[model samples]
Target: MSQAKVDNYKKSKANRQKIMKREKIMHRLEMVCIALVCVVFVGWIGYSVYAKIDRAQGTAQETVEFDASAVQNYVSGLTQD
Candidate 1:
């Protein structure tokens, strides 16, 4: 091999442990970040579904009665002036 290639290989070998340790730490950090994102996504979907169910169950269905004679009396009173 060339002299320069041999020297480069020796230098990389000397720091191989340090490089491997750094790579391991980076891989673990990446996995933790991915897990955190998945948890937040699942939580958001759960909250949305819970809110929709709550809204549906909390509303009361009622019938409103309209008074036409009351409205006609009010209009007539306004027109009296």
Candidate 2:
């Protein structure tokens, strides 16, 4: 082959290598981004479930308790008029 043709072939090969390297880097970045998004999604779901459970626990704690003196005082005040 002529010198000019050989030079052109080497240049093209180098360009192909650079393009392949860039593609690999971009693919890794894409995977990392996907993984990050999945992690955030899982964390949000976990937080939502925990929040619901916490609210239910709070509701369960608010049980009614008997208070006799308060009721008697209220009744006496109403009767005074």
Candidate 3:
């Protein structure tokens, strides 16, 4: 049992650098993926809010009243001529 443990320890020691390098690469990749997901989520939320506000403003503009009396008078004058 002791001999097996020693053999395992030596093998691990020999491959330690490779294992550590792989772990470092994996950690960086994980952080990048997390940051990408957060950016996408925030962008989606911002767009939705912008779209909602734009829609509200559009409706408000559509409901506004404008004076057409000048246009009506112009047309009436043209017809009389």
- Index of the highest-TM-score prediction: 3
- In order, candidate lDDTs are 0.96, 0.95, 0.97
Candidate 2 lDDT by residue in tens digits, 33-77: 999999999999999999999999988896787979988999999
**Each candidate's clash count:** 0, 0, 0
Kindly report which residue stretches of model 3 are placed more than 4 angstroms away from their true locations once superposed: 62-81
TM-score (all chains, Cα) for each model:
0.71, 0.60, 0.73
lDDT of 2: 0.95
Steric clash pairs (candidate 1): none
Task: List model 3 lDDT by residue over 1-81, tens digit each.
Answer: 699999999999999999999999999999999999999999999999999999999887846589999999999999999
User: What is the Å distance of residue 35 in model 2 from its true position?
Assistant: 0.1
lDDT of 1 by residue, 1-81 (tens): 999999999999999999999999999999999999999999999999999998887796567998799899999999998
Superior by lDDT: candidate 1 or candidate 2: 1
Off by over 4 Å in 2: 1-12, 62-81
